[model samples]
Target: MGLGDFADKAKDAVNSDKGEEVSDNAFDKGSDKLNDATGGKFEDQIDKGKDAADDHVGNE
Candidate 1:
């Protein structure tokens, strides 16, 4: 498959229930790591980013 085809398949997978669960878990873990690394100084921004990512991935 070409790049566009691969992207479409990935998007489809991410829009599924199981994929959303995995995506949320990954985002939570990543956000926690970033918060820890930054001593929670950028927690708000991190959360905003996570929200935006979730919206992009059609989590809700």
Candidate 2:
């Protein structure tokens, strides 16, 4: 819904260490925010966003 919400979700997800499970949800939710913030310019990069979020959470 927002950055704060996303962060909260991510925190829990990352802490759980279930990288693959949370990856799609985090990517879809966060990527929507990113796309909205960037005025649709980031629509072409959902995969990158997903991968980045996956890597970040996976590392935790």
Highest lDDT: which candidate? 1
Model 1, position 8: C-alpha lDDT score: 88
Off by over 4 Å in 2: 1-19, 51-60
**Candidate 1, backbone clash total:** 0
Candidate 2, lDDT over the whole model: 0.73
lDDT of 2 by residue, 1-60 (tens): 999999988777666747556665767788888888889876878758677766766435
| Model 1 C-alpha lDDT per residue in residues 1-60, reported as the tens digit of each score | 999999989888888998999999999999999999999999999999998898877444
Off by over 4 Å in 1: 1-3
Candidate RMSDs in Å, in order, are 1.7, 8.3
Clashing pairs in 2: none
C-alpha lDDT of residue 47 in model 1: 100
TM-score of 2: 0.43
